[model samples]
Target: MAKQLIFKTKYTEHLKEAVSSGKSLEFYKSKEFVYDKKQVLIMPNIEAFPNLTSSLDIKDDFKTAVQIYEAFKGLEPIQASDERFWTYLAHVDLFLYMIERWPEVYVGKSSNPSKYLLDHWFISSSAQSSLLRHAISGLWWSVYLSVDEAKGENKYGLTKILFRQLDFPTRTLGTYKLGRHKEAVLGILEFIQENEDLFKTKFEDKTRFVTKHLNVVGGVKPIAYYDRQFFKSELEKVSGNISAI
Candidate 1:
């Protein structure tokens, strides 16, 4: 018989904790929010996904959940109806498990009470598989395991795209994006493609160099050095694309 995979109980607890500490429903009135691409509000709670089953999307989804809590007291009804929402819930289940059993997932500490939630693997299982079937395939994981310093604000850049109805192709955007801002991230890719010499000398060489001289904890400066040129080229290439902004 095939073994069953269940979402650990702690995700619900974390959800509850997020609600307790987040902004009240009334606070959302001051901001504008859209529900399922329909209902609009003054302030809205938004969730983002990379449309995948990897750690990148999982982390992005958690950020989305927290953002929604900040703008509204309760989750909008439409979110539950959207297929992506359910998809994310499943990914988080895996992430929650990874957080408990694997230490590397916890990159930084936060004072937020919701961060403390944990789970224990209750089942005796081996080599679990991804739940996402249609539309979403493979276990969503971060392709860029290591961070780059000058690659713009990758976290924020990723957040901006995920929150919106992705304008570009998911496959294109998913190809190792960089930058704190949209221009920066898109620019890097554009630049790398435009400048072949830079790609070989600056981009490829540094990738090898940084991969060697790296420490996920303390290698910020070196990462920045590698990313600087690509970021600049990224800026010059697609500077006029209105949709990118």
Candidate 2:
């Protein structure tokens, strides 16, 4: 267990500028961009946090999310949303993980490496889209939104389903407002779990349909105020429709 640390605001901005202007490319190539001790601020009253591990498959995001959530389980939503905290992790403790997971950015395969760095290595905003897009914070938020204690031993069942593929979190949930609500996310996952056969293939297309359908329903109704059951029922309405196509 170690004390949590975050980048000082000025350094955070400086790093962002460095990445954006392509000044950090050589450092990335050399694998030598280490954070200066003076640039970090230790968080008060927080401890027992461990460093994150890197994995090759997108499915491994579930494990990474669980690891991060357990380490910082007590974090308030506002604190978790802070860019300083996530940026520090991205640039420091999990720097290798970022490089391993996003090798294209460093290898120059990405058409716009600067934008890739800015998007994945930094927290762009407190918005759901931004939180879900960041390489590290996105993993934490995925578990945060979907973990259900009532599931007892299978608390992360929905989390597993969400990471069964990368697109569900990065594309589907990140792009939609419905993802901001826990109930909606759990409901969608529940629907998928209940009808596993339907989603065994074409998972991305079906999940996108589910989110779009629910978003339309949310427009006419206070879907956010409802529970997970409401989302399951709404999804069921389109189950037959999805099966036909």
Candidate 3:
């Protein structure tokens, strides 16, 4: 059996109470644990593994929390099925409360994200779709794959532009469909970043354009097998006439 956090579905209520009382996170502080900084981390008591929402970190800041979560992914030994996500949802959801409560470094949205966040916390039985719903799980996976050298020598730099591109991070990060082809996503991001000078469309527009190209190309070829050069070419052709570069 997969590790479970044993929250007994207290997640929604825990968050509800915390926000309802307007309390500082002092009451929610989790016990600190050292991150191994390896490809993965092991936390038998995942609940006590530190809070991602806390502005405070045992190491430093929010990014470190992200790093720790990414490492945890490798260690979790989860299966791809929807069932696996249920086992770990409580742990992941609890950690994200810190981010939602004190979103300065992370959420980048309104003070009370609960309006939108609650709906996403978890959907009916769709773990595949829940990637967008669960705060920690979605962002952690996105950052993990984004930093994992899909375009050689660590193109994690792309996230600076990628995440800022409106719904791009929320949509792209949570999506495992295109994720199987990381190079394709990286190639699209690389093109968007480089051509930011020539095109001045809304981030949502850019997302649509990229999604269209991906749907076409990904449907044609098994994108995971392609190299950077091939992915770039497909991105270039779909994007069309780069007058600047």
Candidate 4:
């Protein structure tokens, strides 16, 4: 059994205790959090993930991330209010597990949790970059979006295209406008994948462009009712107007 702490009842209360020390690198291995031997299970088989992160597609890895997300899906950690979500991610050893697997994650090998892991794993604001912010949550959301995109009409998986471009996930995934809606997610990715040449170098906030157009067209008709052609035309319209704005 790995040495670590876990929450039994009060998540927030336990989180306070864990961060109270504000420790890092060495903190990960130290005797602090009361390891209950029954905390929420983290994503298994992460040995290949560090190398996988280097791959822009992350499709296979994203699938693995989904497996992790399902573990927490209806569980208290993710089922609770959005704000308290971090409490579970941080306490769950998602950070420590990574560090232990790859000590390289430690910024300076300083063994200080606050210095290296805290900022990325524990964020207060869900900004545009939040999709890539906290380590574990970011993985889950990325998988969520990518899974939706794969379900769309496009035969070529967009995970490779979208994950490679930071512009896609950062500007859009955290927002309720498109990220929360499967139809919008699939439509936009298909639009982008089909128009690769048009946006090869002209891209700037492509995700936002898709969301903006979705709102406009969706207002006129149900987004789910729109076909592939509609997604293409509306995205083109939005892309054309982006330069004016």
The lDDT, on a scale of 0 to 1, for candidate 4 is: 0.50
TM-score of structure candidate 3: 0.58
Candidate 4, residues 1-245, lDDT tens digits: the string is: 23222233355445544554653344455423344455443433222122222222223444545555544444342432243445444544354444443344344454555545455445445553554555556656655555543346542265545555544554454454555555556666677777676566646555566566677666777666655566667777766665543
Clashes of 3: 2
lDDT of 3 by residue, 1-245 (tens): 34323323344345445534545233223432111123223345443343424432433323543554544555442532232343234325344554443444243454554444344433334454565434445555455545645456554566555556425655643454665465666766677777776457456665666666567767877877886567667667756534322
**Relative to the true structure, how large is the alpha-carbon lDDT of every model?**
0.31, 0.81, 0.48, 0.50
Q: Give me the runs in candidate 4 sitting further than 4 Å from their true place.
A: 1-6, 9-12, 20-26, 29-97, 100-105, 109-119, 123-133, 148-156, 202-204, 212-229, 242-245
Q: Supply candidate 1's per-residue lDDT for 61.
A: 41
Highest TM-score model number: 2
Ranking by lDDT: 2, 4, 3, 1
Per-model TM-score, in order, reads 0.23, 0.92, 0.58, 0.57
Backbone clash total, candidate 2:
0
Query: Candidate 1: where are CA atoms >4 Å away?
Result: 1-158, 167-169, 175-225, 237-245
Q: Kindly report which residue pairs in candidate 2 clash with one another.
A: none
Candidate 2's TM-score reads: 0.92
Candidate 3 clash pair list: 53-98, 53-99
For residue 91, model 3's alpha carbon misses the true position, in angstroms, by 7.3
Q: Is candidate 2 or candidate 4 better by TM-score?
A: 2
Q: What's the distance in Å from true for residue 139, model 2?
A: 0.6
